[model samples]
Target: MSLLTVRNLNVNFAQRQQPIEALLDINFSIEPGERLAIVGESGAGKSLLGAAITQLLPKPGYIASGSVTLRGKELTQLSPKQWQEVRGQRIAMIFQDLMMTLNPVLSIGAQMVEAIRSHTRIGYKDARKMAIEKLAQVRIASPSQRFEQYPHELSGGMRQRVIIAIVLLLRPELIIADEPTTALDVTIQAEILQLLKEVCESHGVALIFISHDFGVVARISERTLVMYAGKIVEQGATLEIINDPQHPYTQGLLNALPQMALPGQRLNQITGNMPSPSERPSGCAFHPRCRYATERCSQEIPSFINTDVSIAACILLEELVSHEEEPDV
Candidate 1:
């Protein structure tokens, strides 16, 4: 059975002048010990999806449609008090910004101890011990020393490691890590990715890794889902999506990668910026920037079509493939 299942989920924010559809018809699932990556540009709502599943969407934003289930239990129907029990215990989130995960005013020890006490009936000393052990597990030197230090005291990588340690403290069933390595250097990023992979495997914990870096996604996840303007435009096995992206948006993202560009040439870039939720296009949200877009693409929304390779939402998908398959005249 899937550890986490999100079905037809839609999210909206009540803006000052209008209602913004932050996420639309998002659907996916994660099995125990499975690693899935959500890749998209800045406004694609990856982080919002993570927050929604954990029942922590920022204010004025809410699940407008669909359901979220964890371990067969419906999460969307849970009370806030019930969610308090579920949030860190069943699903923990390691935000992109490590600072957001830690309390600046409190020492690491205090925050970790409080988190443990809140979820489990553990004594303060025992919680501190667990915290130090997790700190060591994340490869932080001087665990006890680091535990007593504040967030600002550690380097960016170290701080992120501390947050990972805190998440580990809960021994969660699933973890939503939102670009946890983005702020770190390349060496540190690789180390952090390996650490996450090891920890998840050791615990048999499922992972939802939200990232814009396709390379990182390919390295860490078995499956990948591509989102654009709050919609999942394509999803498939990680390697398949990397080797053969179907949707134009997905192709654009792959082409924009530095490795995909020729040497001494300008890097490929997706022409336009992602549209805002309020300013989203009428039909296919990606139509404005999609090179293969047709009049039909601009007039009608595309539904997810199963092509045996990947599930893609693109109006011109069949035509695009046919053109590539047709014999030259």
Candidate 2:
């Protein structure tokens, strides 16, 4: 059985005027110990997907129609009380901003111990020992000394590592990381990625890494899902998508990477900003910015088509498939 399955997931915002769809027809499955990456622009509904899965959506946002099953247990149907039992223990989340995630007043050890004891029957002393061990596991030197330090006392990278250690305290089956390395320096980001990859593998934990950078996820995830304007435009093996992206948006993203640029040449850029949910264009949401878009693209939403290399939702791919299948005279 899949570790997690999300089918026909739709997230909507309740507005006084009318309900606005934030996520539409989202579908995917993650296997046990597998790592998946959700990559897209800032407004592509990446973080919203994570929030919906974890039942942490902000006010006015709610799952409208869909099912989220984790290990055969339906998560969307769980009550707040039931969710408390599952969260942290079964599914932990590591956010991008460590300062916001870590309490400024509480010492690292206090928070870790509280989290451990909240989900388990362990006493304070045992929880403290476990927390220190986790801190050490994340490669924090002098774990005991760092345990007493407040959030402000640690660097950004250290705080992120602490967050990872806390996420490990319960040995969660899955970890939803939302751009955990975005705020760190390049070197620190690389180190954190490697550490995260290793830790998840060693713990046998599935990971859903959310990020806007395709390059960043290349080193961590085995599969990639490309989202755009609240829809999944493409999905396939990580290396396959990186080497031969089937969707225009995915191609544009890979092109914009710094590594894709030649020596002394300006990096390629995808023109136009992502559309807002409230003002999303008609038909294929990406048609407005898609260079290959035709009049038909603006008039009809494209359903996902098998592209051999990757599954993608685009009319161009459909045309290509049809053309290739036609026999020559």
Candidate 3:
């Protein structure tokens, strides 16, 4: 059975006029010890999907419909108390901002021990020992000494390591890392990615790595979901999508990668900006910005179609398949 399954998950922002759909018909699954990346631009609902899975959506945002299941258990049906039991014990999230994720007033040991105690009835001393060990496991130097320091005292990379350590305290089955290395320098980013991948592999943990950069996604995840506006535009193996993208949006993203640029040339970029939920265009939300969009694209919503390389939601792919299937004269 899949470790995690999200079926038609819809998230909406409550508004007096009408509910704004933040996520639409999101569906995907993850297997045990597998790593999947949700890739898209800002407001593409990558983080929102993460929040929906963890039941941590921001104020006014809620799951309008659909289900989030973990190990055959339906999370959407869980009550507040039940959710508390499932959160740290089964699923944990690593936010991008370390400062916001870590408490300024609490020492690293204090925060970790508190988390451990909240999920399990361990003694403070035992929790502290476990916390320190976890810190060391993430390769933080001087773990025991660093445990007593506050978040402000650590560097960005070190703080991220602490966050990972805290998430590992509960030995969660799945970790949702929401751009955890975005704030760090390039070298630190690579280190954290390597550490996160190694930690998950060592622990036999599944991961949902949310990122906008294809480069990072390629490094950390085996599969990739390309999200646009509020829907998945493409889904397939990471290397497949990176090497041979079927959807225009996915192709545009890979094309924009630095490695794709010629030396001294300006980096490529996709034309236009992502549309907001409230301002999403009819038919295909991405139609307005899609260079390959046709008149039909603006009038009819595209459905996902399977290609040799990936599953993509675009009429161009559908038409290509149709033409190929037609009998020749």
**Superposed model 1: Cα runs more than 4 Å off:** 15-18, 320-329
> Tens-digit lDDT track for model 2 on 7-61?
9999999999899999999999999999999999999999999999999999899
Residue pairs in collision within model 3: none
Alpha carbon deviation, residue 210, candidate 2 (Å): 0.3
CA lDDT, candidate 3, residue 305 = 94
Where does candidate 2 stray beyond 4 Å?
A: none
- Clash totals in order: 0, 0, 0
Which prediction has more favorable TM-score, 1 or 2? Answer: 2
Which regions in candidate 3 have their CA more than 4 angstroms from the true location? Answer: none
| Maximum-lDDT candidate | 2
Task: Give per-residue CA lDDT, model 3, range 1-329, as digits (tens).
Answer: 99999999999999998999999999999999999999999989999999999998999999999999998999998899999988888899999988999999999988999999988889998998899899989999999999999999999999999999999989999999999999999999999999999999999999999999999998999999999999999999999988899999898898899989999999889989999899999988888888999999999999899998999999988899999999999
Query: Candidates' lDDT values, in order?
Result: 0.90, 0.94, 0.93
lDDT: worst 10-residue window of model 2:
301-310
Task: In model 2, state the lDDT of residue 212.
Answer: 94
lDDT of 1 by residue, 204-230 (tens): 999999999998998899999999999
